[model samples]
Target: MTIQVGDRIPSATLNVLKDGVQAITTDEIFNGRKVVLFSVPGAFTPTCSAKHLPGYVEKFGAFKDKGVEVACMAVNDAFVMKAWAKDQNVPEDLMMLADGNANLARALGLEMDATAFGMGLRSKRFALYADDGVVKALQVEAPGEFKVSSADAMLESLA
Candidate 1:
């Protein structure tokens, strides 16, 4: 079953590129903060590149305007995520997390078999609001869909 609202976030190590690759734990990322964590199936895919990520980038300031921290994750390596962040010209405050081994996906029971696409284990597109590591809201998109997981939708949930 998928992780539900009110569940304490499962512990996992995700990576980010700073100077070199650095491992960041769920505790470090989510503890004592209201976080908006959004996941994509892969990095650099058209929709993910042109839309999913940019939506978050465009709204990063607005998210902070409401006192929320924002981060985006994918099954790519820290290197790829870093490159994508630069390519997307994302701001320094909008973190890019790398679930290099799908650890977070497995922990959340959000793993998907994308073997047919040669992507292997990938995270279904989703977004959630968490307060000091406890989930407040989660919006997971249906397979092949992208409705409720947008930043606008996430911001709406806060209202």
Candidate 2:
């Protein structure tokens, strides 16, 4: 079933390029921390690169100010995520999570089929707020739409 408010984030490993491709666990990320984890369909895709990721990059500080750690997730490999991070000039603390196998997406029941677009299994464009591993809010966008999951919307939700 789709993860809902009050659900604990499931345990799963995700890749991040720091020093090398490091496997980090969901527990390590969400435990003891208030986090806003946002997912994009794929890294470097038009909407993801142009708007989705950029919004988070731009408002990262605001989240930090609110004591919320922000993470950007995509169903792409670690190398691609690292390259995209470099291209976007993402901040040091803004985590780039690589869900290469769509594990987290499946675990959350948020997987979307993008094979028609030439992209295989992917996660839907969504954002969830969690406090110490338990979800407090979630915003999922409709296909071909971007609204509720934007960084601005998340920031406003915190207000």
Candidate 3:
């Protein structure tokens, strides 16, 4: 089922590129922290590169100031996510999570089939706010739309 407000984030392992590709579990990320996790269909895709990720990169500190650690997730591999982070000049603390197998998306019931577009299974564009593992808010965008899940919109929801 789709994760909802007050739901505990499901357990999953995702990759991040640090000294090398490192496996991070969901418990390590959401436990004892306020996190804002935003997902993209793929890294380096037009809208994701130009807008969605950039919005988070720009406002990362604002979210930090409010005590929320921000993370960006994509269904692409860790290498691609790392390259995109470097290309975007993403802040070190703004985690780049690679859900290469789309496991987490599938677990959350947010996986999208993009095989018709030549892209395989991917994540739907969405964002969620969680405090110490419990979801506080979630904003999932309508396909082909970008209104609700933007960093600005998520921040506003926190306010």
> What local lDDT does model 2 show for residue 141?
95
Candidate 2: global Cα-lDDT?
0.95
Clashing pairs in 1: none
- What shift in Å separates residue 61 of candidate 1 from its native position after superposition? 0.8
lDDT of 1 by residue, 80-109 (tens): 999999999999999899999999999999
Global CA lDDT of candidate 3, please? 0.95
Every model's TM-score: 0.98, 0.98, 0.99
Error of 1 at 134 (Å): 0.4
Residue pairs clashing in model 2 are none
| Model 2 agreement with the true structure over 1-159: per-residue lDDT tens digits | 999999999999999988889999999999999999999999999999999999999999999999999999999999999999999999989999999999999999999999998999999999999999999999999999999999999998888
lDDT of 3 by residue, 1-159 (tens): 899999999999999988899999999999999999999998999999999999999999899999999999999999999999999999999999999999999999999999999999999999999999999999999998898999999999999
